[model samples]
Target: MSTILIIEQVLNGLQSGVMLFLMAAGLTLIFGVMGLINLAHGSLYMVGAFAAAAVAGVTGSFVLALIAALAAAALAGAVIEVAVIRRLYDSDHLDQVLATFALILIFSEGTRWVFGSFPLFLDIPDALSGPVTLPGGIQYPLYRLALIGVGLLVAFGLWLLIERTRIGIQIRAGENDREMIAALGVDISKLYTLVFALGAALAGLAGALVGAIQSVQVGMGEPVLILAFVVIVIGGIGSIKGAFIGALLVGLTDTLVGIFLPEVLKLFMDAAPATSAGSSIASMSIYILMSLVLIWRPSGLFGARA
Candidate 1:
């Protein structure tokens, strides 16, 4: 393959990685701070996509659509946290899992019922509808490039929020000793709701951005949710830095392997079988990477030594 092709694929990987980071960041935050196993997080993502699609269809303003997505998902998350998730905090992992899984069914069915089982499409804004030429004559979609920028900005903002703010201190404290923070006068319940809403908003933003590139439909978040889980696992359960690095690693591995593996195999085997074998392996590359990472560091790359 040509250097240009390689660069393009790398960019594609980065784009994919950043988007995964958006999803993983929130997931890690929620799990890290709340100790809740939320299977329905992805459903929040779907809600955002649907909300954005609905708003865009009615208003023809992508910005408004994005706002709607963030608001809708955040609202949904806060409501669920208050109405259902709060009850599971002291429950066992099995209970948490079962409760959240039920939430997933509720969200999926509810979305299907409202949207009538039809897929919704969000159009790329006129400003971001074309490809732009890079320094090396590489043409990449402007919207995708925008997604990377937005993801990075959000990551930076999150870092500042976690490392440089009062709430950050509370969140860190909560993760280590929730009782201590609560005793110190922090409203633990409110903090939990805020964190959950924040996480859901991030997922929602990701969904809105990606909706333009793909069909917005019920169950769309499940596949991305799986990848996000892998990302957090490889990065560490509650570490934002870990999530970013892990996401990039998985994204590059997935994209580059799928693209180049077959070509490499063709050197030693028939084209057809090489393509088949390459695809099979490519699909498993992220899991293989996760296993390798676990072997090297059981707690994940940035997870506390435990």
Candidate 2:
């Protein structure tokens, strides 16, 4: 591939990686802090997208759409944590999984009822609608570039929140020993709710940002959710640093492989066959990477030893 094309693909990878990080960061936090295996997290993502779409359609303001997305997802998360997830805290992993799975169904059906089966569209703001030239004379979409910036800013903000703030200390303590923190006067229940809401807000932000590019439709979150799970698995559950690293790795590998695999295969076989085979292999690249990571580090790249 040409240098410009390669640069473009790398940018795409970074954008994809950033979005995945947003998803995985929340997931890892919820899993680590709450010890709850939530299959319904994706449903929250869908909720965000729908909220953003609906608001944007009405107000024609991306900012308002994002605000709506964050509010709706966080509110939904808090409600779920209080009404349903709170009951499953002491239950086994299987119970949590089953409960959350039911929640996914409920969310999906409810959304479809309200929004119908059609997809919603989100428009890119005029300010970010055009292309910009890079230092190397490469032109790139301003919106996507802005997305990368947003992701990086959020990541930094999360780091500060988790590592530098008082609540951050409590969160870390809870991750280490939930009962101990509770005994020490921390309101564990409230902490759990905050973490859940924070996660939901992050998911919502991701959904709103991505909705401008992709169709906002029911079930759109499932695929991204699966990838987010893969990211946390590869990164090490509960490790934000690991999640960020793993997200970038998966994103780059997937993007680069998809672009180059076909060209490489064409060198060895017929064009059509090569294209199909390459595409299939590209699709499997991330999974293959996950398998390898698991083989090398069963607990994940940064997971604590049992």
Q: What is the C-alpha lDDT of each candidate?
A: 0.94, 0.93
Residue 173 of model 1, lDDT score = 91
TM-score for each of the candidates: 0.99, 0.98
- In model 2, the Cα lDDT at residue 239 comes to 88
Could you tell me how far off, in angstroms, the CA of residue 123 lies in candidate 1 after the best superposition? 0.9
lDDT assessment of candidate 1: 0.94
**What's the lDDT for candidate 2?**
0.93
**What digit string (tens of lDDT, one per residue) describes model 1 on residues 117-178?**
88997999999999999989999999989988998999999999999999998999999989
RMSD of every prediction: 0.7, 0.9
What's the alpha carbon RMSD for model 1?
A: 0.7
TM-score of 2: 0.98
